[model samples]
Target: KSAVSRVLSGKPTTTPKKKPGSPSKLDERTKRRIVRYMQANIGVTAPSVVASLQLGVSPQTLRRFLNAEGASYASLKTSPPLSDAHKASRVRFAKYHLDNHTDFSTTEWFQGQGVTTTEWPSLSPDLNPIENIWAYLVKQVYGPDKPNITCKAQLRSRLWHAWETMPKAVIGNCVGSMTRRLTQ
Candidate 1:
């Protein structure tokens, strides 16, 4: 065997070769199109979006992409439709947090790897399926064609009612999805 490079010493190490794999089905242009469509039709379901876009990709694939983009698709009742200014403000807030929260050392030290932060935020929300349960509870609190929430007391009462009355099956399904989510 030949001598190995003294990586422990001051000698520089060679860069690792790229991993071989099939390219992604969705290119940048196609992905941008899908995002724009989903934004415009925010209320549409993932399977419906897959059908509408006819992108030859499964709903799961599209959902994975959206998750990576920091978009929430949880079935929650909207407070009100956001205006352009509200949307812009939200974007700015997200960007500011991203800029401030990212660990500079990870970027400086690592190359050709995925985004790294101080915390493993990528394994959040989805991994913990209680997020879906929370969305369901919010929807249950408001109900269909319900009056707008007026005060903190009223909201609290409705929230309590929803939680107490939530179907056991709904809660069970959300919890059960954890294994499936982990596989993905």
Candidate 2:
């Protein structure tokens, strides 16, 4: 009698009923098309892409989709002019690297340090693979799908994400290429 009563009792099933149809506003085909468009035009902003493609999706939706696919947007900004102190620090760093690592043909000794005095260029982004890494970092941080960074905090967060996610092989390749670049 108890089993019969329990069976007769009106109760919802333990398993939730599945909802029919997709939750996404755009279909898979449309999304794929948008991705293709983005791949071709890397520097194009998301808003411009939406406008051009006529995807009929909101900017926020597009951004979310693109971000999910590892795309972000960032504007090019000019670096601030280097201060005298910053310049001096750069010089010191360069001097340290040159002194510790570089092999000079001349047997000149400076301040008993066995280091030759060499003029380090003020800026040498071409010779440094770190610059390439920085460029890669910037691209990764500001993906084609991501929104433009509006504040320092956002920039820092994105930068951290890029740094953490960057592959060791990429860094090694950049460093490896340095010798070839130096020779050229």
Candidate 3:
């Protein structure tokens, strides 16, 4: 009775106890393949990945394994439509660019000019070079060492500053990549 008490009252062992369950159906090699598949296909949900990969694992099991391997899933929210005035401003801006640049008169450029004032599907950011530009501007405006922007006024000021100070070449390069993007 004294020995039992001592054993029960003693500090718990530091070593981890084995979980009570069957071993994982996925081996390390299969897990690595799943990880690689997930990496290759970003923005995919856990269930979708499991179905597409034909991994023969349950969604819950795949999710658990992915979580253990530091994988995360997120669903992107769609942006709301632009107001009429915003649409008008976009049209004006595109017209100004198109009218000024006589050299940019290709069929592709014309198609781009036509779409400038239109509302695009929310999931099509990859089709828009402006998205890349915005990402760059965000990085410049709110870099790791920079102080947080606390208000709308501060954010607007920072955005303007970042835009004005940005190299014309950078903007030009982004615009120039549109053809390559379209081709791809």
Candidate 4:
């Protein structure tokens, strides 16, 4: 009798709802699309590029959406820039060329060699041909969903297989595409 009485007693539960005036929550597909676009455009730091994509999203709206998802403009600015280790490696590698005195050790040596180093402008992965390679691999592995992958390990393994089997001719094609901007 006591067990039956306990089973009949339960507390009500409620799910929290969005507050009024908040931006509508972004869907997962939309979020993934935005991330893919961002990855490809990692080279072009211009807000206008995002606006022009016109995936029903304004540049400011996209910016807010990215911020909400934890990406920032600084990510593009610092990408692929030489780290201290890379810089040191460059300096060390120059030692082998000392016979030419065109090394990067001293400012004079660099200037004498007609070598110039400057800060890189923010990059857009869209401008990079390698970004296309990554897209191609992703599409080959996950295009239109033949079946739902059960786990992250299985997905990763498939992606690795796709990457390994990517063709050299395809890489050449992507590299050739770099000569012209399709967006322009």
Collision count of model 2: 7
- Per-residue alpha-carbon lDDT of candidate 1 for residues 14-73, written as tens digits (9 for 90 to 100): 678887887778899999998899879878888998899898999898888888989885
TM-score per candidate: 0.34, 0.37, 0.33, 0.32
User: For residue 181, what is the lDDT in candidate 3?
Assistant: 84
Among these predictions, the greatest TM-score belongs to 2
**What lDDT score is found at residue 170 in candidate 2?**
91
Q: lDDT (CA) for every model shown?
A: 0.81, 0.81, 0.83, 0.72
Best by lDDT: 3
**Residues 74-179 of candidate 3: C-alpha lDDT, one tens digit per residue:** 7766887899999999999887675443454564686787855343444454766788899999999999989998999999999999999999988899999989
For 12-125, candidate 2 gives per-residue lDDT tens digits of: 336687889668887999999998897887677878988998988888889899889887677756588899999999999886666554554343446367665656665554
Q: How well does candidate 1 match the true structure, expressed as C-alpha RMSD?
A: 30.3
How many residue pairs clash in model 4?
12
Clashes of each: 0, 7, 0, 12
Candidate 3 overall Cα lDDT vs. reference? Answer: 0.83
C-alpha-based local distance difference test score of model 2: 0.81
Name the 10 consecutive residues with the lowest summed lDDT in model 2. 102-111
